[model samples]
Target: MIRHIVFFRARDRADVGRVLEGLSILKTIPHSSRLEVTLNGKVDQLGNDVDVVVYGEFTDAAALAAYKAHPTYQESIDRVRPLRDVRMAADYEVTVD
Candidate 1:
């Protein structure tokens, strides 16, 4: 299994909802097994302006790649591109769970 995690820091925190909605579109997709959207909470430890965290799970790398190239994702990019400041992601194979 592959776990794809993404952190999005937006220029405006209010724009998080639009971005989250865009991500929700992928939940109904056939190849996507699991999708989660989280609103980052105010924590003193991490001062990052990251407002949203997206976690996606796929059976394999191919499935992850397909999710990235999906039209729904492209639409998301288009929607959030204007309000985004920076975005970072990491993907790793799940060994324990």
Candidate 2:
């Protein structure tokens, strides 16, 4: 199994809602086994907010890849493109549970 994690920072606070909606679209992909989206609940000491986080679980790297190239994701990229400031992604194979 592969776990793909992502974190995004928006240029402004108004972008948060649209980003969350875009993250939710991942669940629509056929290969997506599990999907979780969370808003950053705490503010940093520097007064910066984390914005959003997405955790997606798939059967393998190919499945994860399919999810990334899926049309829903493409549409999401279009919707959030203007608002996105910084984005980060990481993928890992499940070692134990």
Candidate 3:
């Protein structure tokens, strides 16, 4: 299995709602074992700057790649990119016991 995680920081606080709405499109993507989007609830003591987080689990790299290549996903990225100040993502294989 593979886990894909993304963190997004909005350029303007007012854009958070719009950004979240755009990102919600990911949940409609197929082949993901799990997909979720969350807004930051509280300020971090360490001052972490992320405003939103997207988490997804896929069966394998190919599944993740397909999700990324999906037109809806691409459209979501296009819609949200302009509203975000920074975006970061990571993907890794998960080992099950």
Candidate 4:
């Protein structure tokens, strides 16, 4: 299994919702077994720099790749890239689902 996690920070605080909305486009793509886009709860006192989060689970690298190759993925990026200051993504393989 592959776990895909991405952290995003909006260029402006006011645009957080827009950023979240933009990333939501990913959910419409069917390549991932599970996908989510959400606002950070900011429960961590040490750092609250992250504004939005995208979490996805895929069966393997090919599924992950297909998710990225989906046109809506580009649409999401085109929509969010300009409004975001920082975007970071991490993906790893795990034995457990």
RMSD of each: 1.8, 2.0, 1.0, 0.8
**Candidate No. with top TM-score:** 4
TM-score of each: 0.85, 0.85, 0.94, 0.98
Candidate 4 structure, TM-score to reference = 0.98
Query: Which residue pairs come into collision in candidate 1?
Result: none
Clash tally for model 2: 0
**Global lDDT of model 3:** 0.92
Off by over 4 Å in 3: none
Q: Ten consecutive residues with minimal summed lDDT in candidate 1?
A: 23-32
Residues 27-58, model 2: lDDT tens digits:
77888788888887766787555688888889
| TM-score preference between candidates 2 and 4, better one | 4
Candidate 1 lDDT over 1-97, as tens digits, reads 9998888877777777887776667676667688887877758585856778888889998998888887888887887778778889999998655
For candidate 4, lDDT tens digit of each residue in 1-97? 9999999999999999999999998999999999989999999989999999999999999999999999999999999999999999999999983
